[model samples]
Target: MASIPTILTTIFLFFLRSTISQQIHSNPDCTGRWIHIRRLPSRFNLDLLTNCSQYPLFDDFCPYLPNHGLGQKTHAKSHSWFRTDPMMLELIFHRRMLEYPCLTPDPNSANAVYLPYYTGIDALRYLYGPDVNSSAEHGLELFDFVKEQDSPNIWARHKGHDHFLVMARPAWDFSQPLINDPPIWGTSFLELPEFYNLTVLTFEARAWPWQEQAVPYPTSFHPPNLSFLESWIHRVARSRRSTLMLFAGGGGVSATPNIRRSIRDECENDTKNGTNGGYVKLCDVVDCSNGICEHDPIRYMRPMMEASFCLQPPGDTPTRRSTFDSILAGCIPVFFEDLSAKTQYTWHLPEEEYGEFSVFIPKEEVVFKGLKILDVLMGIPRDRVMKMRERVLELMPRVIYRRHGSSVDFRSNKKDAFDIAIEGTLQRIKSRLQEVAVL
Candidate 1:
């Protein structure tokens, strides 16, 4: 019933709207997401690194603090690998925040607030000893300092919901158990009411979440620039993946309820049988018993580089650092459970189904139902596998933390793990703030 001009205008409007919708789904819109980073006292962050040797924990963290938490640079031939520590995520994130494009000095105009507190090292004092009084002393002191330092408009505006902090350790590291069940597991930093309200970024969040969001663990590979990252992707894509599976972890001795032992047993069985289950020499392994692979990365990296799928069973916690490491090697990850990664890294990785870039085999199916990993993997269509690998290459940059430098400009437009985290956090807070405004 409409005229030709009206029909043409309507069609054009529909096309424009559809194109905009596609763009919204493809590109992350970071409009009006200015972040105000609150300067915490040196004692909470840099001071902890200064006396890293005297901490209640393990190794001297002084060496890890240099190179902006990337750790000592390695002989990066094929990759920009580093002897990166898992304990320096706070600093890595801090450095990224320092170089963030939307960082604003005025808190009044800020959409979110960043609290760069090194809670991991600060909580190290309570990690070993059976002391509960000093468990959350640093965290409690931090809240007191924040209350004294910042304006009421910043934290008080949304009751710490808009404020976030990054801790290199998992939520469990700071979440002290109600009773001394383990006696010396973690500090009580996360247990406090003040910390509960703040949005926390961790290496691994609790499977059942409160406010903690899981980010990627620091892998050895950190490309200097986008071109370097692109080159790595192409190199790995072209590399011959002779092996089907790669596993790097301790062979569990306790056979009663062991995931690793089961995997190791199956892997060894497949390898030993020579041509079992319609496959030949299917799996490769890097024996990581006694923390060998943790220190020497190349042991696992070599195997992962030549493998198609990397088996990622739950370690001490639900997730392992090797998950990201395998991705760096262009190996598609095989997750045993949802909590391991499926539910953890929603922001950085794809938000759609996990099947796009990974293969998930339920742990129960393997442990109880007698599922053979090689059989399942070998059965997948080659085209699907290639598609998954291509998807992984596409997603490689999102999982990585690109090394920050002075040479790169603010609008360099390379979106890595840090950028993803910031964008995700800003959008999350924006929605929360809108809900608050509505109420």
Candidate 2:
């Protein structure tokens, strides 16, 4: 009894619904293609491991994990694993890429090529050892290898612009000048003109040349699968936060200003006075200088989960691995420097206002003017605090590097840090490719 137009509208609606359902089930985010450069000498990566015992922080750096560094069993009763030397991102990124679905064996079919050079670990071999010349030699060798590559390959295809290197250390570490009055730590690998156009994914990037992208520092929590990740998220969300704010770091020294010391002093002094009518719980500072602050996940994560805010000051560099860990624990980060998060991590953080997930107090206000840390955090409304915490939780997956060989499909809604980074890198390459085509 329905008119022709009514029947046609019903059929059109049904077809549209089916199309949307198909799109929802499709793997769109993991569509980028990449090829790993296997031509580099194995010695660059393998040589470091041959004498792993001599490397600095050997125990922290060289733990043999069963699942391709997913880590060994923390205990027989649970599936939880622990990893150290978050600076080992170069190794992990390379391993994860092999298993990444977007990786293609053929370079001709790829949009971007990855150079899996262990630049950080290799530098550590010489920087920490007695051989300074050996360090410089390593840098020269890598430069020569890339410079010698044939044309029509990934490096020459786009004049090294389409090629990328993932480094575990900050950009300054590799890009240090050869001649300087004060003599900085790092090699001249980044100083080569041949690498000017290449993209470098580093823990912290310098302000200039926009090709240096900042990725999340690796954290201790590598969930075995999606279920474990989901469970932790739920647990942290419901965890009763008893403390107003927490600071877990040693008193800063000469090269590093004593802002951390000042923060610790204020936190301890406030705790003694029973301040904020006993509502504020100021915890003790963890002495990192004593080696007690290394590789203990529970010690670090528990307090972060229980605290409303985690204080982040500049470490040896402006960035700290603890910033990402705080985000993973769903505790909102309070940064003292703009470079800590705002200026550095544009690729991973929200493009909109940062106030949605974090709080920033100028370093001078806290150190020079002697502003109260507890009072500042207490001023934020309870509802706003809840909203910030939620946003931090939402950002957890993007900051975490999931376990390699995990059964979880990255193309699904559960995209991890690796997924996000690859997608972003691919998109950048695609944009560059389009620009080149137009020119």
Candidate number of the best lDDT: 1
For residues 86-165, write the lDDT of model 2, one tens digit per residue.
Answer: 66787678667665555554566567878777778777765676655443354677666766753445556677767787
Best by TM-score: 1
Pairs with steric clashes in candidate 1: none
Tell me model 1's lDDT, rounded to 2 decimals.
0.75
In candidate 1, what are the lDDT values of residues 1-439, reduced to their tens digit? Answer: 2333343354335334433432333223445777777866667776566566675447766666556677766663544777788888887787667656566666677778999788787777777433445665548788887776657667777888788888888888888754555545678778787766788889888866557888999887777766777788889899788788878887566857667777887877764434643334588778788776764677888788888899999988888999898888889999998889978999887758579899999888888888889889988988898999988888888788888662373236667788888877887777777777898
**TM-score quality measure for candidate 2:** 0.85
Alpha-carbon RMSD, each predicted model = 12.6, 12.0
Error of 2 at 79 (Å): 2.4
Q: Give TM per candidate.
A: 0.87, 0.85
Deviation from native of the Cα of residue 405 in model 1, angstroms: 1.3
The segments of candidate 2 whose C-alpha lies over 4 angstroms from its true place after superposition are 1-32, 56-60, 64-66, 134-138, 149-152, 180-183, 253-257, 271-280, 409-411, 434-439
lDDT of each: 0.75, 0.71
